[model samples]
Target chain A: MNHFFEDSVFFGVTLSFLSYGLGVLLKKKLKLGILNPLLVSIVITVIVLVVTDMDYEIYYNGAKYISYLLTPATVCLAIPLYEQFEILKKNVAAILAGILSGVLTSLSCILAMVLIFNMNHKQYVSLLPKSITTAIGMGVSEELGGYVAITTAIIIITGVFGNVIGEFVLYIFRIKEPVAKGIALGTASHAIGTAKAMELGEIEGALASLSIILSGIITVGFAPVFAQIH
Target chain B: MKYLRQFGIILFISFLGEIANYAIPLPIPASIYGIIILFLCLELKILPLSSVKETGKFLIEIMPVMFIPAAAGVLNVWGIIKPSVIEYIAVMVISTIAVMAVSGLVTQLVIRLTGHSGHQ
Candidate 1:
């Protein structure tokens, strides 16, 4: 099997698509929030690689092509933000305040962990951008001398956690407003959380997407400053 | 043909973003630049929504799948992460919940105080 596909550029890409497609199917059939397609796909891919004794570097060679699409996809997020311009205009103040508060909260929490847990500077900075999307978070982590792989993993876990329990948390906190719910998910969990927000409502999706960009920028500005703490 | 064009536009903007990312001194990523540039183009009507809508939706819909490769990269670093995994989990869970609660509540509070119900 390895010899047959060893030289193919599409090998890893094919595996990713197949696993992700199966994940989507499973989610549709199971109706479980915890059955997140991304999470499922990662598990499946990892299992396949481990079972096949394939080197991660080999898998990433082809898989990197799919990753290449991430920037363009991120650019496309502007469409949703543009489409919901009216609501955005009306709630500009609330939107800014929500995202700002979330960014600050995330930073402060990381700072507190540094103090309480006695975490090293690398670990602290790695966790600093955990709340943002993977693309931006990885950049921030690398810039701050944090482990990029650790940051990516942390970001994914943060997003999956938010996607799974975002609604429950909102309900528990009595957060009934659509804009607020969107802000909560996006600010706290990035695009994956926005996926859940999109399922909730159109306004929610737009607001969530907007928060992702805002929170990400704000985190980039502050991450370096926070890195100086330890 | 339409999707190809739309994808081309997005790719072109992303390339510009990469350039800006190199030119700028900030820590911001190229993707953010791409997002800002594309957004400005839309807001200014230099690029119509129809030009990128379908392809944009397709990209967004598959956004989750894009992270798989990077997320899977985590497997390579388990040795470094294993010792402190508990602390990492602690910080992530606590901070994530705190952020969600604070952001949601603040947005709601601001909306109510600003004399808007939720949406018009």
Candidate 2:
């Protein structure tokens, strides 16, 4: 079994697809917030390697190809942002302000954590991009000399947390406007929160999509500046 | 054939972004440069929506799966992360909620102040 997996050129890719597919199925069946497809996929993939005693390097040999798509996939994000452009135009100021505040809040919070917890610069930079999408966040983390893997995990955790409590937080704040709700979720949670936004209403969904792109850009520009703090 | 062309366009833009990243002194990543360029092209009607729409959707749909390899790297660094796990979780939870509340409230306030009605 080890030799077979070792020699197969496509073994890692095959396992990834199978695990991710299973994760999607489980999410559909279980309907649990903690059962995020990405989280499930990671768990399954990790378990498979550990149980099989397979080397992570060997698994990554085939898995690396899939990561090559990350850049193009991020570029494709522009399409959705473009599709939602008209809605963005209608309430530009409110959307921009909302996303800006969210980005600032994210930065300041990370800064405070660094000071309060006495986190090293590496840890500080890793968490700086925690609230953005995984693709962009990973890039920011790498550029700032932080652990990209830890940043990815942190990003997924943040998104999952946001998805779970996003609506509840909005309700507590008495934020009734569709635009405000969308901005809050997307700005705070990235794509995972956008999933919740999609459930609320069409306007909220569109606005959330827009906020994801805008907030990502804002974080990219600002993460470097904040990384300078520690 | 169509999907191939769409992918080619995205790849070309990404290549351009790579060049820009090397040229620009800022800390911005190539992917961001690609995003900005693609967005401008679409906004200026330089690239029609149909040119990249279908393939773009396909790529985005599968985005999460692409992160598996990177996320799995965490297993190797567990020792480094173990001690600070609690602090990491604390910062994430506190900041996430704070950001959600602040962003929502500020947007709500701004919309009201601007008299946009926000009803639409």
Q: What is the lDDT of candidate 2?
A: 0.84
Q: After superposition, how far is residue A217 of candidate 2 from its true place, in Å?
A: 5.2
- Write down the DockQ of candidate 2: 0.58
User: iRMS for all predictions?
Assistant: 1.7, 3.0
Please list all clashing residue pairs in model 2, or write none if there are none: none
Best-performing candidate as measured by TM-score: 1
Candidate 2 residues B1-120, lDDT tens each? 999999999999999989988999765567768878998999999999999999987887787677778777667777777899899989999999999999998988988898774465
lDDT of 2 by residue, A1-230 (tens): 86776677788888888898998899899987677677788889999999988899889988988988888877776776677667667778888888999999999998998799999999999999998887678889999999987898888778867876887899899999988998899899887677667667656766776777778889989989998878
Q: In candidate 2, residue B55 scores what lDDT?
A: 93
Model 1 / residue A159 / CA error / Å: 2.5
Q: Point out the worst 10-residue segment of candidate 2 chain A by lDDT.
A: A194-203
Per-residue lDDT over A1-230 for candidate 1, one digit per residue giving the tens place of the 0 to 100 score: 77656666798898899998998899899988678777888899999989989999889889999998988988888888888888888889999999999999999998998789998888999999999988789989998999998998899889978987898899999999998999999999998898778778878888898898899989999888878878
lDDT of each: 0.89, 0.84
TM-score of 2: 0.82
True contacts kept of each: 0.83, 0.75
Q: What is the DockQ of each candidate?
A: 0.74, 0.58
